[model samples]
Target: MSFDGEQYPGVMAPPQKAQGFRLNHTMLRVKDPEKSLAFYTGIFGMRVLRRLDFEEMGFSLYFLARLDDDEAIPEEVGERTVWTFQQRGLLELTHNWGTEDQDDFAYHDGNSEPQGFGHICFSVPDLEAAIAWFDSNEVSYVKRPEQGKMKDVAFIKDVDGYWIEIVQASKMEGAGR
Candidate 1:
């Protein structure tokens, strides 16, 4: 079950003829940039790594990261704009004024369940602290810190109606399959 990456680094490398590729970021459209920024930055503690304003389009894009390092920005050149930050991973927030209808607008109504795109997850050090922060701030969560089928995993959600899965490693002893 243990992968010794260093021992078999070649196996993990790209094919000899294939170009190198890495996961740059996942972009999600937001109805309100300010509201989305507030939830991501205020509640989740993500920092605004950079901001770009599309003057002709009348929309702004902000890249936020949980990491404090600025060097994590990708060097790849393309039309896809990006914002980089450090956390468990990087989050790219893209706002396209011309393509508002293309945004992912799926949501779980009270009677219906979530389908298609599920939710974004974050690993936290303390589930209790995260839950308390959400509760105190009046943030709604689909499920509080409850025991998952596995040992110590928990979940929560943000104001923009995104679910966050929080896993506490200390509780996951032999729970790994």
Candidate 2:
């Protein structure tokens, strides 16, 4: 099951000497921390690992992750900050002060014209249950599992309008068969 660079033609292999590399987190600028935090924490079930505020810069960073049941979190703030960076697959929300008060401020979701950043994906244990939960929560959907060519996959919008792809790996295993 190991990766074979030959599978991807013309893709160069990584340097043998390179080490200790991993994707830490992806950041998205949010207009309102309250709404964004609620959507991510409440809807997605992600816990706020750490919140860093900069009074002088008029901004704050909220790091969140879906932790496993056995995962141990440090009690101290300093220790937790160190621990948060060590984990993988984290989402960071950045809120600039006063943007929420402007009444017209918003970030480009990158899914419209001239798209760049596509979407963040979440793998769930039960696709049907997840979709039902989303429906109950009144979450806006771009695509449902049954509506598109790609079956067993769905896309929903966050409060900030960022697309979040929902997938259940077990169901997707039989795709294209």
Candidate 3:
């Protein structure tokens, strides 16, 4: 008698697979949400997607997106406008009110040398061009592209002293040669 797979009663059922999740956003606690927002929006060219004020919690949250174009919309719908560039990713800025002692608060101290949790990274099309732009703007950078195992990595700091890592994906393969 031929044994069919379905006819075998002793066979156990297959295990279920878990669903995958994608990265949504990274949240950072800022000393001043307004100031942080201005740096990211003004210098980095990010747009405010949404802003929520939690008076009860004494905290405010602002969602920002990096947009390609710098066009301004009407004041009425400006806040709700969805910038095209942020569709790729987003940055979430959180501000807690009534917190006077920021010294004890956990925040990225740009004053200190680059150590653990160095900076946020962004992939760029042209590394040389980006570096040139940084030079023209008088922005200081470490210029260590791909130190150690991580190649094609460049470091720069924003106006607020937050470190930024610029990476060129294409050059990563031949990096450190």
Q: Pick the candidate with the highest TM-score.
A: 2
Residue-wise C-alpha lDDT for candidate 3, range 56-141, written one tens digit per residue: 88988787776567655436545453442234467777788854356555566444756555567778889878777777767767
**lDDT (CA) per prediction:** 0.63, 0.93, 0.67
By lDDT, who's the top model here? 2
* Residues 43-108 of candidate 2: C-alpha lDDT, one tens digit per residue: 989999999999999999999999887888999999999999988999999999999998888899
User: In candidate 3, which residue ranges exceed 4 Å CA deviation?
Assistant: 1-20, 68-88, 98-106, 109-116, 142-152, 175-177
TM-score of 2: 0.93
Native-referenced Cα lDDT, model 1: 0.63
TM-score of each: 0.66, 0.93, 0.61
Ranking by lDDT: 2, 3, 1
